[model samples]
Target: MPKKSLLMIGVFLLATTIWAALPRVSNPSPDYQTQPTNDGSHVEKIRAVWPGPNPEDRVRARVVMSGEDIIFEDGPTSQVMNTHSIRKSLLSLIYGIAIDQGLIDLEATLQELGIDENIPLTNQEKSATVRNLLMYRSGIYLPAAGEHDSQITDRPAREEHEPGEYFFANNFDANALGTIFIQETGYELGPFMEEFLATPLGLQDFDANNVIMGDPWFWPSQDTRHLQYYVYMSARDLARIGAMVAQDGQWGGRKVIPKDWIELITAPHSDLEESHVPNHLYSHFGFQWWFQEETGTVWANGYGEHFLMVDPTHDLVLVERNFSGNSLLSTARWLSSGNKFSGSLWELIDTHAMLVKISDS
Candidate 1:
């Protein structure tokens, strides 16, 4: 091609890309309002803070909520970040939708699918159920052999649990699906999710480019953009999700997820502490979604420190974007310390809300 032609083509593509990147000026759900709907000018931003003793380890993050901007030199609001295991939250939502659509039967046993303890699970491990898998209560333990077969299973980003616990993580990815098949399972997790969940939810952004465009467009080596891969989401997108879930899987009354099914999934299935939540809060977990006791609040958390909290009772959604993979354990140790990572993020919101309420009064 001639140099002039190439240059014109490049400029045209750049302009198209920039135009496509702009947020759509469409109406939000009538049930929910954008924080700064018009003007788009006073949008709040939060900053990520080190929040620890390690000065170099601190990451400044920006936070954006219902329309208010809270910027922390220490934190951030709109910067897109990976949603580690929080991806599981979205996964469960997708799975629930599939089941609601009659595409999957939660009660179905793996044995019925010819998934008997074969290559993947031994005789002792075949008792797992799809519900059990979603609940992280499966019988299969992290495969031994020292993660030698790590990239062989359909594990999530990272799961911290005991042996015989249906646990898996995206880290190191010993459970990479290519190596391990979903034997002794009712339905193949990957193909099923790709067809039912990813295809339904707006996550087409993640899978579409890869599936349609090979190699350079999609990283064939890692398939890193896969759903199991930490998803990159924006604050507004996350809020939209929160709003969707709040409406019981209905987007503008279109029945995105079966209404009855959404209620079933959000309802308390097990105590959260039993699943590793805190005692002070009546944190409970169901399927993949988590719940709070008095707060009736639930949240989805991602690694590298991200939280998407929804308080339906208050019609409030709070999002905190941070990086906590390095200091995860440290946050646990210094949780009592000022601004330790754990749930301090919530306290920050409560503090702000209280101030707002007082101002209103």
Candidate 2:
């Protein structure tokens, strides 16, 4: 074969292989559950919120559903960005996995875990065990440890006692929870990730570790997908993950994540509605995962209104990547205060003009 012809054929085959894995456009309907697709319009003002001022920016937005990603960006079959604390939520997958394997007890107390330190944590914080931390109720005084709020402009930790300062303080430091996990459990992060979650999921091109060198160093990758590159992938893969959970952790009829582990990971450990906007009703956290609490929506969100949301009730998975949004925490607070989509995860994402996804692909 001519060298140029051979190259063309190789390209065609690669494209075909990627096409098979890429998502297909989903037919929509008013009813997507117990019936058919509830075709939602992509004509919202949301585009103003996608990351990157122009499509040329390294940032991209996406949306996936039912094993399809109708929203896409750039020219690659996969990409990357930063999911931030969203990584914490993914950590729950392992936590639940450990519990399901009888490596840890869900009901274990803090003292049982030997975590009650001399720190002045409140009774709520001290009594909190691994479960409370999963639920974000360890009551640990974050600002006390030097957390700072971001939007205050000139605000400093040594400034004043902000109303919600302790929890949301921008404090400019790694929350230490990541390192705490490895320290408490004696499990190395990278090796365990390869062993427990990544390998079983058939996921490569990712790394989860403390890639820093400071008091609270060890930053996880901003690329959440495809090996810490903001978890870059087609929406079909995201839906596949959700569908796996919806199907009780079964992937092509194989048990990837333990069944009991899925249930525990998705189940709530705290009050999600603690923050809501537009509608005050809410679903919150189940360990690191986000749940509607009311609608049984499980999610892991990022800096941009980047979301991987699943409505287990209706077998729906909706992902939104906005340029900037304050996320669930601030968004709900801003909304309850009777405002617009103020301080939302979507808004935070929109600010950077990065990537977001939503799909019925």
Candidate 3:
């Protein structure tokens, strides 16, 4: 065989092996229910409120669905974008499944799970249970991958609070939960997500290959023991997950996530008034989800203003995404433009107002 031909054959073999290793759903569910056509009035109502001034240029995609009908959708809802910290919420969903199957014990301490970091966790810190991490009350203050400067600055001092005594939105807890999930389940986050969550929910644009784990752009040289689990998902697909959560984890007449687990995750576990979270709209903290007690809303929030909001009160699911780009250079460029989408609870409120107005009319 010619040298060039041999090289091409070797490359082909490698690619085939890699492709074969990727996870696939043995039987993917049917596509999610969407309205045959978008309601024009609903579209106009949502559009009038969205991209409101600041978020206009940065809002990349959005999907608003009520029950089984997609009321409004805009931008490339199918385009995959880095979901930032929303990966934590996805991990929470997976945890619910794992816990139900006896793969993980919520009350198990970090010491019991053999969870540690490069800097080493104190014996007291190791006493924090898996449940504590889920509630962002782990009280482990070590630097974590994907944390913003504000989080680092505001992080409680070592031993400032005992396990489960305080609630600080620390990425360390979120990232460590990812590590625990992989350890307990013997499956990577991506494949587990595909087999357990995405397949069950019939997500339209989920690709296990796109799910990655690494340091955040600003914290590239951080600890390697527990990296951030970054998921790339489309707004439309996220809406499906939100809808499932809204319905108490049932999808297509099948119970995907346990109803009790869903309730536990969305129910407030942290002190509402004492938590150090920057957002006033987040009235309480659930397992890994954010809660607005007044409106009965649960949401998964990510950096760059990405949100997956499930408002069971109104039977509404809204997903918003701001493309931070895929590569470091592209992400840097996007950040340099000074157009990152902002607001968390306020954005949800604005969107919900539109829904309310449309409903009244």
Best by TM-score: 3
Among all windows of ten consecutive residues in candidate 1, which has the lowest summed lDDT?
208-217
Question: What are the per-residue Cα lDDT tens digits for candidate 3 across 228-256?
Answer: 87788878888888888888888877999
Best by lDDT: 3
Which candidate, 1 or 2, would have the higher TM-score against the true structure?
1
Judged by lDDT relative to the true structure, which candidate is superior, 1 or 3?
3
Error of 2 at 317 (Å): 3.1
Instruction: Provide the RMSD of all predictions against the true structure, rounded to 1 decimal.
Output: 10.9, 14.0, 6.2
Residues 30-55 of candidate 1: C-alpha lDDT, one tens digit per residue: 22233333222223312222122245
By summed lDDT, the worst window of 10 consecutive residues in model 3 runs over: 21-30
Error of 1 at 337 (Å): 20
The clash count for each model shown is 49, 69, 0
Scored by lDDT, model 1 comes in at 0.46
Instruction: Give the Cα lDDT of each candidate.
Output: 0.46, 0.44, 0.80
| Preferred candidate (lDDT higher): 1 or 2 | 1
Query: In angstroms, how far off is 197's CA in candidate 1?
Result: 8.3
Off by over 4 Å in 2: 1-58, 67-77, 116-124, 144-180, 208-240, 272-282, 293-296, 320-361
| Order by TM-score, highest first | 3, 1, 2
Candidate 3 TM-score over all chains jointly: 0.85
